[model samples]
Target: MTRRILLFGATGYTGGLVARALLERGEVPVLVGRDRAALDRRAAEIRPSDPPYTMVLDVHDVGTLRRTISADDVIVTTVGPFHSHGRTVAEAAAEAGASYIDSAGEPPFIRWTFEKLGTRAANRGARILPGFGNEYVTGQLAGAWALERAAEMGVPHRLEIGYFSTGGSLCSLSRGTIASLAGSSLERSYTYRNGIRAERPGARSSSFRIGGRKYSGFSIGTTEHLTLPEVSPSLQELDVYLGWFGKASPLLATASLAGPLIRRLPGAKRVVSTVGARLGGFGKDGPESHERDRSGVLVSARVFSKSKHKLSEITLAGPNGYELTASLMAWAATVESHASTRSVHRRTGVLGAIQAYGLGVVRDTCLHLDVREVESAVVSA
Candidate 1:
């Protein structure tokens, strides 16, 4: 069956990689964007330029986008700042009866998107899976694996997810990421502790080491904390930290502290795009610099249960942060497409990619792509 996918933001960096990945996998999705010239350039690069189709329409032009994607087609949207475009795209997709997915950066945005659109999607049988990118999917999947192992051993309690990378940011972060950064007015952190969600002041001493390298990691904007309720309602506490191999610790630390302040600036939104574009790529120095982040996820959990078992570990490692993100987003679209076609009624309502796709499926795919599994183990009681 032909999977009719309407790809929004097809001309952007993440969009380009996702489109390429889709083409490589032998799928021709209808590319949609507001820029005719950029869309033309992207289409020319695809294997068969004339495979499907491309449309230049603003996402806010709900009338056009709504009618265009108003069908059973899957809507793969990479446009973000999600606070801005998320509702427009999600609402359009839901009304159109299209399965929706995107790479949202912040938790509040993810929460808002799902809360506002979740019911519509469920009612319409559409999948509104956000954070399908590196931010949450890989980490969440790894956490899921660790929790499953803990459950098997009868000691599941707390999950701590740490991301260490030899590569850089996974997907193409756009102006929206910059805007999110620029608009930050206060220092903040989210944690799920003992089955309760709480916000706290950004903590110091967020530094830790993995693989013998001293990496300084702090809580940046991520949904891992938000997803705990969905993944494991019984989770006692879930913490996610970002570790940088080298000097990035200082920049990351500064970003964490200043993010909220900068976000509140009057002109911050205008410069967010520029900052994100400049800071998007990885530095050539490798592993240490925030410029070129090497991708690695270390998930360690302390399980408190009826059994004597207490510790569980799982890691989903990969290379080429940007490339991997592109691959992941495309893969997510593929899963949603396939699931939609098969009428899989497993569950709906802001479902996670790994939960939607299953570990065996992701594990096999990772193996094929040579994304190694460094460790998947459980500490016995």
Candidate 2:
């Protein structure tokens, strides 16, 4: 049973890592991207026991890409600016009945995926699993853990899961993700309450401290805002806090308030990218820098119930955001390649990573790859 994987964006930082992971794991993926020289170079560098194939294909050509994909194959894509390049890949994978997975974090891109390709993919028995990367996987896992504790205690009304990262994000954090913050006023912050979504904008704010520094936080972004409701019906309030600790936290928070306005202006990416590029990089010295680029998620959740079981805080951290993302994507592809998870085929509606992959599987993958999980318990008042 030869499972041919069609990997788009193989030339990218994360994509290259994904390709390497697949080859190293004994899965021969047909790496596809626009760069032949880069792909060839990467293929030469990969120390696979055997060998992997590389192809020069533009995902924008949905027809050709789909025709090339087969039912037995799986598609792992890491190309972002997903708003510009993801749908075609998903559509092709769905039409060909190939299982599709990608690392998409922007809310709009995902919203479009659900609206346009979700049903088609499901109907064809092809699973379109999004956010298999960093955004919601860890947070969703934390949500599941909170719900389990809530059910055990009884009267589980709300769960607050805050994600604090002292990490360097991949260059994939596109203008859209930043722009999503601008639209924070579009809807009130929401969390699931007894299997229903409840909105609470006032509860969304900043000024949280993690890793010995104060970082600014905000209510924008759809990961916790959207996925928590489905992962845990008992959670009425889900607030995802990013960059909530550090001397620069307040500035980041203030910028979040102006995200919409700032993004509206021209040259936004140019300005941001130039400044970010000039920052050179977070060196190996700072702990926060260690946390960021190394790929670590700090999940501090407070579960409310009778006797309030303030469960242990958990942190999943690893080496390099892009590399971890690629590894995770590769792992997801391997899992989907096997028809063993037949239940995933029957899953029709839009699904989150935790629901689709399971917490233990995700947790273990993170761990096997040196993703550190730190835990601490707190007593209820």
**Candidate closest to the true structure, highest lDDT:** 1
Index of the highest-TM-score prediction: 1
**Model 1, global lDDT:** 0.62
Per-residue lDDT for 126 in model 1? 67
- For every model in order, what is the number of clashing pairs? 24, 13
lDDT of 1 by residue, 250-353 (tens): 56555456555665787665576545535543322112324324344343333445344456666566655546666787876776666544466556656666
Compared with the true structure, the alpha-carbon lDDT of candidate 2 equals 0.60
lDDT of each: 0.62, 0.60
Worst 10 residues of 1 by lDDT: 283-292
TM-score of each: 0.81, 0.76
Worst 10 residues of 2 by lDDT: 280-289
Model 2 segments more than 4 A misplaced: 48-51, 166-204, 207-216, 262-295, 305-319, 340-349, 377-381
- Superposed model 1: Cα runs more than 4 Å off: 48-52, 167-189, 194-208, 230-233, 244-246, 258-310, 340-346, 375-381
Q: What TM-score does model 1 achieve against the real structure?
A: 0.81
